[model samples]
Target: MPPPQTTGIYPSDSITEVAQSLPLDPLGAGSADLLAGDVEYRLHLIIQEAKKFMVNGKRGTLMPEDVEYAMDALNVEPILIPPRPLPLPQFQALTIPSSSSHPQQIYHLPDDEIDFATYLKQPLPAGVANSSGVKWKAHWLAVEGVQPAIKENPNPTQRGASRPQPSSTSLRPQARTQLPQELQLYFTRLTTALVPPSPTGPETEPERHRLAALTSLRTDVAVAGILVYVVKWLGESIQKCLMAPTGTIGQLVDAVEALVGNEGVFLEPYVHILLPPLMSIILTVPLGPHPSSSSSNQPSPYDLRLHASQVLGKVAEKYGRSYPGLVPRLISTLSKSLNSPPFPSPLGASNPPSGRYEGSLLALSCLGKQAVKSTVWGKAGENISRIDDLAGRLYTDGGGKKRNPLIRALIKCLSVIINPKPVDITPQANLDDVSEAFGPNLANMLNKKLWTASEILRLRREELEGEGEGGGVDGMEVDQA
Candidate 1:
């Protein structure tokens, strides 16, 4: 009667078909329907239990091994029996290795050895370089033998640096660590060109891939996963760009601008990799000179900075809203790099001095966008203030480098911080024609004010010292003033 109305998980007729198909129809006719009902009920119970295993493991897909593991945990024997392994040929079981023979060896049997020659024959893709980058730094925790690389804090380096290498001396366990081959070659070619800055602009390949990546950044949901690659490419390009001011440095700058300005994609994920290279370029001394100049091939230090400045400026603009730590971190990095009371403000070639930093001053001006002015002033103002005090205290009547680029940059950065945006003035106000004091103009004011302050303080102190030295006037009065 209409297959029992097909209401149950399994219809009676379907069960009868199963029963009839069996060699001996042990459950005859109506009885098959009863058995089917019982089977379906048990199956439902097994699945409900199986799902618990899935959730506990934090996996969406169910695996056979998981079912077996779950069943064992539940105190229920699994239905599927795993096949027995082929018996090992009887050679007497090997005991622990003798200390005298090979003390380095544990008790592994010869049969367990792998066939290296056979595996070695497998071919790898062409132009694939071994990325032997990540190395374990020696660090100790609770005990000597326990490696910090393992157990916790596994990988300290970003993914882009060399792939993780297997440590030979690492405690007991170690984990050993592709761009396409042609793409790899193109990146290499690009870096080489940057280092030398030959006449050839980068081949179309890198530019094409960069465009592709930019496109994918907009459309692809999985772009975040491969951000390491993108960051690496741009960082390396910036690094190379910093090395020399010629060749196709502009392309690298463009790459940085594009990556930073990409609207939809969030670079917050890869900022760690991105920031270091960009900063290094920003502050790295002697950005390569112009290729064409015979007298001094290197571009003017200021010129070198302009490239770095544009990139850093774009980054600050895009990320200033989301990431608060950037400006503060940048100050610390710049502060440490400076030669506190810095080498007396880079004297130019004309002064028979070591270098010039006008370019750096200009670059820093670009970086001080209006977005994070207050944060820069409040959060990092102290460091700049300290440097300012030092720079002033050490100031002399003589001007060597014309200005301290670091101090000048800080001053320009401070002005922007103090006045985050352009000051609105009435048409009749005295300052209407004025623009922001950026670059050399700002540097001139900063250098003058600092020099003036130092000179006045020194003169007053000198006068007091001279009076004390001669007439021995009240020392207490001089000290109080």
Candidate 2:
């Protein structure tokens, strides 16, 4: 029938191709999609933790140590390698001939049975290809922009190579498919290169090619086996990368965005597998503190949260309506984060706010926008209406005077939720309502104090301005707006 239905990030046949390539088929014959989905789920969790590492460091790059900490957060320990004793060694000198007097007649032992003395005494034989003194002959693979005719370089005398080819055993019905030998070879190499033996070591040329292939595939709308194969390969080894403390998730996220951005691809099959991990990335605490440092020294979850929030918001906008529950879960997650205490306290001194406002604000704004339809919001969109009050409550917190990134995000999200653009009106018609829609309460929130509390933004602005007249803002903070 139709290639079996899959709610996983990869198709069943893609998983089957990978499984069949294995010696023992640990996932068995028909379990490819299930196994693939499970792999993605684990990877999803790893990515969630990876963002924490990014957030904790206050940097854009995901360091190896941060991945290790992400692994720790997931309770996935690294596979410790036990040291093995070196085998007792013995040395022997290899004395190769520096310059043979008879360079053309290099040393050779008699192959055909003859006394060594008699063979040496005999004249060098003619009409035999195996003569030890055979002289070198130069043959160019190509000349004058055209291949020189040689034994191997000549056009095939037959339809293909002269070798007797074995019959093929297909992964699917003969009636259904017949992939070329080159493509089969490519598929094997693609899967192997994507999922290496260990997710450690410097990235090499082959891995780079595999990523390029993945990027190309992500842009395709067709339900190709190769697309599912790459996604499954990524999903399978995600945990290993985290355990190895590798920074590969950055590339992985890029590939994901490519897939999500492809307007041609129908994502209904994959969204369930995709959404939860993205949500985790947005919500997880930044793994900012180093392993050696005292816990109190950890940085704010600023950078990582911002990056994840943008990605999460994008996914919500694209897929929220496809799965109605997505909005509810996103709202719940953001609510928990925003409502968390500002500081832990017998001593009371801690980070200014207990939350990262930017991330919650993003999740709130994007999910609210995408899930506003009556069908997606449930109760004929009553739930979407309630979000305005929740957003407004953030303003009630402690004069809302500390203008961190979070406050900016919260106010912007509130404005959007409270005043979505009217469908009937054009863009030019909206300028007048901007001030009226934001109202006196919002105006007070955005006044001169917002500028003062926005030291991080202002300082960053100055630094970039100093850099050049056409300077761009740095990091994911630029993405907040």
Candidate 3:
């Protein structure tokens, strides 16, 4: 008989499309009619039964009302198939054979057959007879293998009697108790021969050699002493130079730059001292009396301020993360400078001199960089906000129409604050806002300067990823470039 053509029943186009798109005889049979009989009919029956199971209480077979009830309950359009009389005898006959084979399978016994406690207590078979007995034997063998051959004594002392006793002497040969008197004299004579002659006498070769060695050691000691003294002196000199109005700002700046430029010096223990004084100098510069004022006639200290600011900026660029305490102070100093007027202008204008404004802006920019550091971000979100607020004010009040150096400085500061690197520190609300405000600007600027900034951002990301792979941040920075 020719098979009935497949028909669509679903309300939506999707289901009908799916059914039609399915190739007829997907199993590649020559005719679609091959899927039309008992096998296909049984599959349809199972699906209908499953749908009935999901809705109506189970009965022997699904009824027409049950299908209608399911369609309404599930909110699906009804799908109908022609019903065939249930082949109860055929199904019963198939089950009879399968049920008869079940009893012979004792190993895969049902739970009803298993008395778990009795099975556990049963004596292990003397030898493997069946699969169950073999499994029991295998388990026993594993347990036996793991059992300790020599039982440990619960009351035993921590150290066993078998432990080796310490010997009176070391295993290595002891150094000779004492040099022979003649050998000691011979060494003394040899040492004397190496010493150079001194002014007092026509010394023997031994005496002269001994003198020479002593003189060389003395000279080296003096040189070392001089170096130590000079370092202390230089440190003091730099400190005085920073504080004194008479001190040469040029010399102090050159010294600071030299000290910082030498990577070794910057990383040294004493570098901390160099920073605060240098930072102080930088801070003091922008706040110095304006060059246009009567005070400007008296060799303005403005140049000193510029040098200080430059040094501070360099320090921040190189070691901002390493020295966290410096960041807040730098920010505070920059803030004060930004708020203060340049020395009173000759024209009585409240505005600072151009140079003072420029220096102050540069200092603020450096502070911005420090504020963006991860350590700072983690704990000083408020500080970051302060930097943003200051920069925003400078940008807004200063006006974007003019291309002043201060504007450029403010822009740089904004960039640093916005696109801060992620650090171990948790960010505060203020910090988050600052980061958000600056982030878009950073993104735009970074996109334009991607070639230059890519490596830096990549390194920062790598550091962040590496931080996760590693346990935590404690020892991580030691290995960072």
Deviating ranges (above 4 Å) for candidate 3: 1-251, 263-267, 285-307, 313-324, 332-361, 367-404, 417-481
- Ranked candidates, highest TM-score first: 1, 2, 3
The residue-by-residue lDDT of candidate 3 on 134-178, one tens digit each, is 543222212322322233422122223232211111111111112
In model 1, pairs of residues that clash are 133-162, 289-298, 289-299, 290-298, 290-299, 302-359, 346-401, 347-401
Q: List, in order, the clash count of every candidate structure.
A: 8, 4, 15
Candidates in order, TM-scores: namely 0.37, 0.36, 0.28
Best by TM-score: 1
TM-score of 3: 0.28
Count steric clashes of candidate 3. Answer: 15
Model 3, residue 76: distance off in Å is 88
Worst 10 residues of 1 by lDDT: 168-177
What lDDT would each prediction earn against the true structure?
0.48, 0.48, 0.44
- What would the TM-score be for candidate 2 when compared with the true structure? 0.36
Candidate 1 lDDT at 17 equals 72
Writing each residue's lDDT as its tens digit, candidate 1 over 1-481 gives 3335224577667777776788864664457667778878766766776777677679998767667755643335676855556565545445565658754433443556768776555554444434454333444552432224444434323213432211121111111112444444444443333223233323555445545544444455444434445556566556654434333344455555665666656677666667776666556544443222453433455444566676776776667678888755664554344432334222112222222233334444565544323332333223334444444444433323445444544555544433222357321211111112122232344443443223323333555577667664566567778
In candidate 1, position 165 carries an lDDT of 17
